[model samples]
Target: MNFPVQQAQGPDRIGQQTAVEQSRAVAEVQAAIYVARQFPRDVGRSRSAMQAACGSMALADKAFYEFPRAGGKVTGSTIHLAKTLAQTWGNIQYGVSEMRRDDEYRQSEMQAWAWDVEANTRHVLTFVVPHAKFVKGKVEALLDLRDIYENNANNGARRLREAIFAVIPDFFIDEAEELCRETLNKGDGKPIEQRVEGAIKVFQQLGINADRLEQKLGRTRDQWSGADIAQLLITHKSLQRREIAVEEAFPQARITGAEITSKNGGGRKQGPPDDDPWAGQPTK
Candidate 1:
């Protein structure tokens, strides 16, 4: 077996593809075994074994199916050997991918649970009390308050808990109390992007960023004219309705936030005051 081993920066997505092309016949047989026979599930109870088999099968099938007319048995054997080596060397990559996928699936389940909790929380709270919108200024204030509560060593757990309680509405607090409490006890993970990405996944699950929102909001007008303002109002109304539905559906999740309407609020009432649209705009 004369397989070319790729330098391990990460899992060999492109390199594996090249190997597959060079050994198509053997690879097709291996892929057939994987997809048709369910070799991974049947091989062993351990997940590592399943991943190894799956990865090997992928390499094998790609090689066998994409081989040139002249490529022979030696090429097939080489692909098989490379895949076997990858099973050992790329275990961490496989495990991390599997784990992240599993986490996403679990997050979906949690979002459903959060939605149910929100429905109940909103029903109970809306009947008893009314709360105003937390606009941009409020959002900034809350973020600052949260930072203080979270960062302060002298703030103590009780004070921090109180701060969180004050920041969220009673309607939201009822459902999110447990979640916030958990966050207070166990701090959020590092890498802001990961946490935000996880939040976006939940946002996706709730149909917040769905084509539904896009269709309801639609596209903005070409100019910052009255037509654009009307469209903005229409989108704002649509989003307002969604906010209500979201609150009534998922109280635990923080879906409500300030949306950017004007890029420069104080600077300009409308788009460039000049008639020339590209006056200040740059050339490519």
Candidate 2:
């Protein structure tokens, strides 16, 4: 009986495959550049479309992120906003790609790029994302595939946002951000009181209580205004994206049982345990 033998993939075969892939990628990019040059974007129409999109309360809600930084909250446009601008502005190629994975280092190298095919301008950022998470003031290795992927994706998304902005005009981004803030402040035509209540419910689902939110804002829940609610909405988006942790957004001090009893008139309410991931925070 004759048996068929399987041939091993040689170095030459690997090299040829790499070359073919590179050639294909070059061709795709060139084709895009040609198309972009042929049909340039209309600046006026693009700007108008971007403004219309930013004026939407739904899009505005996800268009920005805010996080505590250096004793103050830092606000900025998010990946969602960047992507929207790229689409509306036209003739842009933008993406993030995982270039390599090193098991020994437990990290992945990612490449993010945005190109203005029409203008032949491009911005690229390459960085490494560790397969780890900070838990309880310690770095913990990620063992699950899903967790590692999420970790990389979260970091990559931020870098991709940067790359997209680098290619886009700074003035355009600023204008869109302003429009989004105005839309967020205006809200979905709900009364301020109703909106506050709705925002509280949303935060509650994320393990943040009214007390914590009040503390974060340095005011009572009743005192929260439309502007304050708008800021909280941006912070909520940041937390949901994993760009900032709950502890960082709303820090609470540790209260002893005695302290709790004293503060609550001897009826201590149950709180998260010391070991809880979202416990032990104090707001500024």
Candidate 3:
């Protein structure tokens, strides 16, 4: 028996798939709205929960990031804090999505959205992220799939933070930030000297010496306060997340053989420290 050949339906099939996806998304949003209207959040309870979360030292340490912009430092809450607040606040849906990819441009058009399901308020941001990184003041293409995904995620996270904040109340955010600052200043039950030492060790692993850090803060190590240590921790978190480059954070710091020896105790260079100061601390 001879089999009949079938004609390809490329465009039609893709169109159908796109329609189906759009319909599914619409249905999900409708369902979310319905559920939110049916069971609205308690404002008092949500505020209390968010305040308690912000009171965590570990969470507060990673909540904010600072980066230099136009001769001044810009500081703001990070995606980690936004997500935590969204969860604690309840009745919210937020996420980042890649809407389209342009191989020719080496970029992806993305959207970050936050929907206040209870209040029916929504915030959406549409932007593009280049699949490239700055290395030594040069733009370098990200060839690896993992690298591309990470780059998108890092850029998406910043936008997502903004979207979530736009939906949440500004007063709530302000109060939470104040609580976080208070928590950071309280020192996590550890002595100030020990906390400072741990922080210095952490930065040393990143090829930054205590002197460079002191220079960045314009203070001596002995004169550093809990607030200063908190700032350093935030900067350290930013460096780890690649939100800011090492050179940008510590412009004067240069890795030399002597510095490497000091970090490694005059031994071979190794990986990051296995013992994290905030290891046992709760993130949220």
Per-prediction TM-score, please? 0.15, 0.79, 0.78
- By lDDT, the best candidate is 2
Q: Write the per-residue lDDT of candidate 2 for residues 117-190, one digit (tens) a residue.
A: 99999999999888898776699999899998988888888999999998888888899999999999989999
Give the per-residue lDDT of model 3 (tens digit) for 131-173: 9998766999988889989888888988999999998998888
Which structure among the candidates has the greatest TM-score? 2
Evaluate model 1: give its TM-score. Answer: 0.15
Residue-wise C-alpha lDDT for candidate 1, range 1-284, written one tens digit per residue: 89998877666456777777868967754555445334322213333442444333233222121111222211111223223332322211110011111222221100100011111221111111111223433733222433433322222322323322332245432322233223322323334334334434545655554323333335322212333232223233333433224432222222222432366554423333223668678789
Record all residue pairs in model 3 with backbone atoms less than 3 Å apart, i.e. clashing: none
Cα lDDT over the full model 2: 0.88
Clashing pairs in 2: 251-281, 251-282, 251-283, 252-281, 252-282, 253-281
After superposition, the stretches of candidate 3 with alpha carbons farther than 4 Å from their true spots are: 1-27, 253-284
Q: How many clashes in each candidate?
A: 14, 6, 0
Candidate 2 vs 3: which has more lDDT: 2
lDDT of 3: 0.86
Pick by lDDT: 1 or 3, better one: 3
